[model samples]
Target chain A: MAAVVEASRGERDNQDQELVQRALTRDPAAVAALVRRMAPVVHVRVARALSRRRVEARGRDLRADMEDMVQEVFAALFESDGRALRAWHPERGLSLENFVGLLAEREVVSILRSGRRNPWTEDPTLDTTLNELDTDQQSSAEGRVASRQRLDQLMDRLRERLSPLGLHYFRLLFVEERGVAEVAEETSSTTDALYAWRSRLGRLVKQLARELDDEEEVSDE
Target chain B: MSEDLPIRVAQRLREEDEALDPRLERLAMGALSPEALAELEADAARDPELARQVALFRPLSSELQDRLTEQMSAPVAKVIRPARWTRWGLPIVTLAAAALLLMTLRGPSALPSYAGRVEGGDVVLRGEPTPAAQGRRVMRGDSLLTLELSPATQVDGAVVARAYVRTPAGARAAPGVPEVDPSGAVRLRGVARELLGVASGTVSVALVVARPGALPEPDAAFAPSEGPRLEVQLLLR
Candidate 1:
């Protein structure tokens, strides 16, 4: 069954790559196909992200905002000689739809952040850590293999500290990279409750990090 | 100093991970067999990260799939209407009419010249033509516009084409995003109302084809330096 799934994915990847290649060359049919195929995925992702915001306060219909966002997402993909389209690496295990969906989420997050006066008040170090981790993943293969044991140990420690619900939140927000509203909906919780949980989790993770650092210091001494 | 530990842990986790498995995505969509799902869940039990992944995939995939199906099943007119003219209003009618008359008297040559290199290309105006054949081709208010790139000008890189309708009020981006047919011909349909707006007179439809970054800005002067461009004047009444 896994083999069948893998085979189907392979076939779909081939078709996606072909369509993307044609789109890169501005082939109208291929471009149209791509827009039609990815628009809904982008729209869903954007809408999910926007669900956290007060759309009513913004004085625009949610559908209208979603429509504009969808167009902007496509514009970004086709801009700069299709630079974003060319960045898709299916060999890395992400399908084109997922890739575009992820891009849409990031775009919406960026837009949301921009609307705020001080978006960085919630742990300015988090972005830096994410970027550093992303760089590590891209730049080192042997280092990654060597780090597997450490990663497993860390995960074990983190799991020990978290309750079952906290663990679920970790999985949804951090591991699966889902939007806050979607995670809240899945867990049958309100966004307010989820936000509280997220803040608590952040503090817990930081505390655990401090404990690990203390342990290392004691061992060194 | 303690803050550095989380970053270190994050780096290690990222390094240890490979890209997401496509099979997991299928499982999330409920396409996997019962046996396959059982096997996946068993594996997930040991791997907390994978377990978390499995937990979220089902809802995420289901939502996206449902939305995609809904959008695909929607009628074409309904889909196109909101997106094309969401920014336009009826207040521009008088200004657009005056602008059209001025452009009509100025002749087709009065349209901005393509200062950039012009490779051979053509903009074929589709729909029924009016009896007035003097200055520019007059078409009914509902004509579809077709843009065809000559075989010689089809280049190797990303060629992007954008259409703009120039009126006295200014240039409004034509509502219909161009779709290419199977034969490589680009078609912009259902844009007559958008291009004509509420005012009907002489409208200049400028089709700009260029490499992605070189495409002309909508409100700026229509001078591009990268690829072929075509302009056509239409009398819509």
Candidate 2:
């Protein structure tokens, strides 16, 4: 069964390569075909990314925003003489669909980051952690020890709150840091199901963080 | 410290999952040989980022694949049937001919069109006089410009208007978000010099009206067939 799936994937990759070559030569049919094939994949990923944002959609229709963003993703691909599309390397094992999905995810992230008014208030700890990750070399030994202790405490609380399956998911998605598709396949779950789990996990983490903050405030007092 | 620790750790770990690498994709797809896979796994153990990437690679679902294939089955454009016009072709041709005849008999239909001209720093209806125009040249020394558009015919559906300025440098979309009045007229205000850019030659401003989602690219050449369009040329001194 695994072999059959791999064979099918390989065939599709070949067809995608042919279509891409035709698209690069200014073939209108190829361009339209490529857009039609990839739009839904791009749409799904963009929707997922937008769902993860803390900011409200600001009374704008999210479906419409997704559609426009999907168009922007295609425009980026086909623009500049299809420079981004040409960069896809199937020979190296990256499929066109996955490549486009990755691009869409990155674009949505960039858009959300740019539109952020106040980064600290939105998700301060996580934002600070990401910033620190970028400048890890500057951290003092004391800071590192405190950070490690906090991480261990958080992990213990998470283990108590989450079910075994949920903990496994957290391990795969956060600790191991796998892709949604990859994680879904390993868990024998659908992408939609995995996304739901992710959202639930995010909410749980935020709630726990707040509780921890309250405890610290009481201790400080 | 403990309260925020869990969320921050999770986020940092997730953030460490870098962009998809082709070799990592191969590992996920089971394309790598056993030895290669072991070597990659060993390397990933040493590198947290690589471990995250290797874990992240996976193929799209069969449902998505089916959707893509279904969409690709349809042709991008309607097939022109000049060579093979045998069965359904004659009827299609007759229907097209009848539609053309009806259009010709009805004369030009009342598709909405716009008329615009510069009055001092303001773009208004062609016949309207601006107070600034009486004292100064229309296109000179104006820091800001107002563009006003009104449909010449009754609009049946939602109409959208976009404005562009063409200069020796090239064409660019005029600044300012368009405001639509209840009467189906549209108005935009932008800086005159900025709209014209730094080019010191003939400048043309175009106002295009179309149904929602039908506007052409800002830099694309104006096609009347696309929608009702109006252009006014100004010679800069």
List the DockQ of the predictions in order. Answer: 0.05, 0.04
On DockQ, the leading prediction is 1
Go through the candidates in order and give each one's C-alpha lDDT.
0.51, 0.53
Q: What are the chain A TM-scores for all the models, listed individually?
A: 0.50, 0.50
Proportion of native contacts kept per candidate: 0.04, 0.05
Q: Which residue runs does candidate 2 get wrong by more than 4 Å?
A: A1-7, A115-221, B1-237
User: Which regions in candidate 1 have their CA more than 4 angstroms from the true location?
Assistant: A1-7, A55-59, A115-221, B1-237
Model 2's CAPRI class?
A: incorrect
Residues B108-144, candidate 1: write the lDDT tens digits.
2211112111111222334433222212555566443
TM-score of every candidate: 0.31, 0.30
Task: Score residue A5 of candidate 1 by CA lDDT.
Answer: 11
Candidate 2, residues B1-237, lDDT tens digits: the string is: 244444577764454334334355344332344465678888889996566444433223333322332223334332121211112345445644775676577654444544332333433234334322222223553344544454443344456777777776677776535555322456554445544453345676666666677676877634335455555555444
lDDT per residue, candidate 2, A1-221, as tens digits?
A: 00001112444567677778776664444544565446656765665554333123323444445544555566556656667788776654456876777667656554544444222224344445446564765567546645644554455456556643566677677677788899888666888998888778877876766777788899899
User: Interface root mean square deviation for model 2, in Å?
Assistant: 22.0
